[model samples]
Target: MDVALQALTVLAAIALGVRTKGLTVGLWGAAGVLVLVWVFGLPPGSVPTSAIFVIFAVVTAAGAMQAAGGIDYLVGIAQRVIRAHPNQVTFIAPYVAWLFATGAGTGFVYYSILPVIYEVAYGNKVRPERPMAIAPTASQMGITSSPVSSAMAIMVGLMAPLGFEITNILSIVLPSTAIAIGAAAFVQNKIGKPLDRDPVYQARLAAGEVTAPEPVDIGVASASAKRSTWIFGTGILLILAFGIFEGLRPVIPGADGPEPLAMTTMIQIIMLIVALVILLWCRTRSADVPRAQVFRSGMSAIIALWGVSWLANTFIAANEDSIVEGLGGIADNAPIFIAVALFIVAALTTSQSSATIAIIPIGITLGLEPWQLTAMWMAVIGLYTFPINGSQLATIELDATGSTRISRFVIYHSFTIGMLVMAVVSVLVGLGIGGIFYG
Candidate 1:
């Protein structure tokens, strides 16, 4: 009875949080923590300080890059590519979107290229939905694979203690997610009616509701833009080098033997250095960094992670024994339940970092192996299962031809099939790769 009541309290807090996004989710989570500690007499859990620092560091670098026009530089390149391969927009557009988000460490970059994608496809008479719907979905998938993303920060923090490295995580996620996007694009290319045959599009065309999309103007990349992008890319490569070849990092004397610097500390230091270099070399004003969209979104993510992770850790710590005993059998007999739980939580939270911080600890407590958890990590992409995501809504609005749309049944929106296919394929592919590594 006590455990059930406590679980109900956690659920209620999550419900309220999901209803009001941004800082409110964190506020509600803090409220839940208050109730749990004061009312239920539950002891507090350790704060996720390491994960928070990682997010702050990575976001700082990404924000600095954005402030220096690095994002614009990348978008210009994407525009050129899309325009160059107008006939293959459906097959090529999602990959470009995925690469942009992956490189920028934020999905907001996808918004810049959406217009280009729509213009290229609509101009070519290709069904706009074919590329428009899946492009944003592919952008979200990139977060799971991004080395500097908030979701990756939380994931690396969680798995590091278990002897896994960032390379291990990326090895499974990058290939799986890339392959998943291709599979989804192939399927999406077949589903929607061709632009000319679609009745709604034709009707809109006849009524003058659809106008020819204006050509996207991709201006030349500035010196600062090019400099910042190169600096940021170098930072990412350095981090990967450190992860892949531990010998590259400095060895510090320890209580036992000299050990290489910790990856978390290395990452924080590297990202901070990257930010400083961008500010100096790119001539970006310090004031502009905080105002960048990546900074704002990343800061908001930190708060949500702080509050929700605290609330969840507290509740789980208080009831760890009960939860493990109750669910351990299922975890052993049917490990897939672990992935399903992650998917459902991600869908409910609608924030990849929030979902990761909240549920991954519970999976750890359930005695699941790190490789097993990593194999299922891509399931967090389920955040797009609902059409309420900003990226999805933006995709719909950007399509002047009205091919990208939300169905009356919200679940049946334009992104559903692509999102579903990507989720299933990524997880399956991740499992296959994980087996080769740790099976």
Candidate 2:
């Protein structure tokens, strides 16, 4: 089969899957793999077993926490902070969103708090779009810094052969991305007219189309909710601490004397243990676990990654020589092009883990350094460039003031500036950090 035709098949599968929505995309991806195997005579690619399991276990724990009211408890704290610093909401709100994503290790947790950001900013006469637009993007950016994020898991595994570990990735990404998100918040604060001075908002108000978003009345916080919140947070801290201090994980006797637990297995065990604790002590209904938002989103990601990554990898493996011959000269001369390629792939696939699995091997094959690849990891957050996903749609919906919107050109959506700022700044910062420490 012609490599161009093979590539087109992969693209067609992605387009069809995205168009159909839901689980169908994954099915399409699987179908692509079958077509390549049966029609093109390509070898079967390995499933992303480690990435899938890590996502499942971590999301199961997060979902358990959500079902037990732990999510509400965390959001309650964020609400109080926003209420207390109404004048500083433009600055405070994005960090609150960042904390939620960083702690939960998935951007889905931001949905529970998006309404709060809108309400607080609106009540204070702030341009709701300023914070509303950037908060969710900031949360997704937080994934790279999240110690247990599935994307980070894939990144860590990919960089391992280059002598980079989870700790090294964290040291570079955490501070770099954190500061980049803060920079985005600062820039967003000045993005549009203040709510009272805004023309669109005033027109809506004059036409009786806009009103204050109804205040959310979260009932009293329960003891179980508080217990679950702390327990879940503690679990996140443990993951961070162990990730930073490699010796903390228990070493099992091995032929090599002793071997520390693999990070993948460690994450699976820790998250499942947290879920068990939440159920046993927090009194969470076991039946509700799979129904939680985190679980549903995680499962969708797993399916998307399973099919998409497999199809992509199969295509790439089949066309390795052709790809190398065509792009090798440019890659050798300007390796930073690798990051640009990743950003483009992420925008198209709309899945960070999928993009990472698809392209990082090519970087290695082209002799890009570990630090270079680590910095390029920041480029995967480009999934927000198109703004068609659930989180972006939720932001557009939650803002009653109509200040948050998608422009006629889809690329000009509310999140474009912040996402671009974050992606650029984090990649540059990661590059600098990786060079200094890993050099």
Candidate 3:
């Protein structure tokens, strides 16, 4: 009966992701775990914490960033890049989507960038779906390999006992990200009418009014604010420093273990604080909206992540053993298994952080080698399933046709295809295992 209930709960969460609707409502399926906890106590002591503090922090962080026009700054940059050279849009779109899907969480990326891509596609007589494909696939690469991502963190811990070095592990996973992006691009071009002169979306383009998109309003420089290049340098320095922190975390001699902190969480905290200070400094000198409004925007955005985190944690706790076992058990066929695991967990959790925490550690423990582990990690980048994933969702919302609903059948089945493709390749590439089991 308990197993049956777990199955039902899992189905419910995936159903929401698959259907591309009732996003917040879809996450409600995880509440089933709270009920289970009431009945079964808890899964384990190390179960992912879905506490309120994270919720507070996420919401506050978003509010702060938005108030400072950080998201606006990003959008302006994307638009400039896409508009400058139209043909490049087809090729670079996937990488851009992947970057967002991985770094920003698929849902946030989808929601934010979809409008821009939609406008770009519409402007160029390109199929909206063509560009859409890249984001989901690319997203998988970005998140799985990202040090700040939870899955990477989990794998970092999981691989430690297996004698895997983080540096070598990165080398293997990076290529897989490229492969996922390449495959997504291949598939997109095949399905989509070529932008130079395509028919399917072209008819729609003719019917639809095309116009120049508004240049993004990257906030103007304040007279009081120094117009020096230091801000740009600061941003670059922050990124480089972040990379250094992420790369060095695993080598810190006590970075891995139960209840240990991941570099992502720490860096995120630091970044959040820096963002807040930047906001405050800018707000004080420049006459903008009231301070209250400034704070509120970032707050609202951040709040959403907390609920998102809970949904990720709850689902994993309920089905941790099955997920880890299922993925890890694919010993001889490890790469394929990893691919399947990536899609399944990403679809259900929306946030890679939660899925990574649930699955990566277990796969490592099950004897997946660094290459195999990286392959599995790389294979996990399928991002198109749930529109809730920030980037994919952004794509769907971006569709000017008002007809970009991603049916459950399409996403789940597509994932199946993607996994099989990667799996078969993994076998040929010596990354898969046909038979292995560990508990």
Candidate 4:
């Protein structure tokens, strides 16, 4: 009873922090930690140094790429590809979102291309909500698939003890997510009336209330832009390749004899080196690095993780025995319910990486199978459960048809169906595939 109350207090603080987002959420996380120590007499938890470092390195590299116009260059290519296939907006758009997030190692990259996604979908007379709703979800799905994403970095590190490798995680999630996206796209396409037929859209159009969205000028890709973009792209490929083929990494002598490089260390080293190469090769001004969208968002994520994960870790560690003993039977009897816990945590934290950092450790000590955990790990993509995220907000704003909107009740919004569809499909597919691999 005492432990449960303390846990609820910590969660209440997090809830308060989420209500006042930005740096405040992190501050709330800090308060939760402080309360645990000061009031509950719990020892301090170790900060997630490795996860934070990996996040910094990834952001620095991604920021350098953005500063060098690499993002614009890629967006230009996406625009061209998307433009050529405007008729397939729903199908091609999600993959485009997935690809950008996969390479950039952050879903926030979806912002750059979202306007383009909106334009293509709307101009082609396709329902804007279809692409808008699913694109962000797909980007998040891509995070689990991204080798260097902080969520994957933390997950891989946590599952290593269970004899899981990065490749194993990828093999299950990548295909599972692809199938899930396809399923969501099919369902999304059939959801709403056509733009011409939607009474709300027709009324808005007839009233001349619809405004033409300004075109994004991905200025002509220069030599430097192309070079930087290639560097970033190559770095992504190398990370994935090295992750898949451990032999590519040089083995070094250790107490255990010659051993392959650790993935966490490898990710940090590769990303920072990639940043350095991009800085020199692309001639990016150093001053613009912090100002880049990826840098700012990445830092926000780092702070959130540092506070929330640390606080949650402390509380859980202090009460591990009781938690495991109490929840063990339920977990054993209904292993799949772990996804619900993950989903709820993500909804509260509003960050997949942060949620994974905070909750996966507890799940690990629950003695769940590596494959089961990895498959259900897709649940952290529940950023839309709260409907207050930037991507969701931006999606609502971009839809001139007013068809994409949040309900007055807040949770019954445009993204509700899409979110539920992807979450369910991904988990089901993941479980089936995971069972095959780990069974």
Candidate 4, residue 103: lDDT: 73
Better of 1 and 4 by lDDT: 1
Error of 1 at 121 (Å): 0.5
> What lDDT, from 0 to 1, does candidate 4 have?
0.83
Candidates' C-alpha lDDT:
0.89, 0.82, 0.47, 0.83
Q: Best TM-score goes to which candidate?
A: 1
Writing each residue's lDDT as its tens digit, candidate 4 over 170-227 gives: 8889898888889988888887888888998989999998976776676698888789
List candidate 4 segments past 4 Å from native. 211-216, 253-257
Q: What value does the lDDT take at residue 370 in candidate 3?
A: 60
Record all residue pairs in model 4 with backbone atoms less than 3 Å apart, i.e. clashing: none
lDDT of 3 by residue, 136-203 (tens): 55555565554333345445544545645444455555554555556646665555335446553356
List candidate 1 stretches off by more than 4 Å: 253-256
Question: TM-scores of all models?
Answer: 0.98, 0.93, 0.63, 0.95
Error of 4 at 74 (Å): 1.2
Task: Give the alpha carbon lDDT tens digit for every residue of 195-286 in model 1.
Answer: 78999899999999999888878999899999999999999999899999999999999878999988888999999999999999889999
Poorest stretch of ten by lDDT in candidate 2: 156-165
* Best-first order by TM-score: 1, 4, 2, 3
Off by over 4 Å in 3: 1-31, 34-45, 49-63, 100-128, 136-141, 145-173, 194-269, 284-335, 348-351, 364-371, 386-439
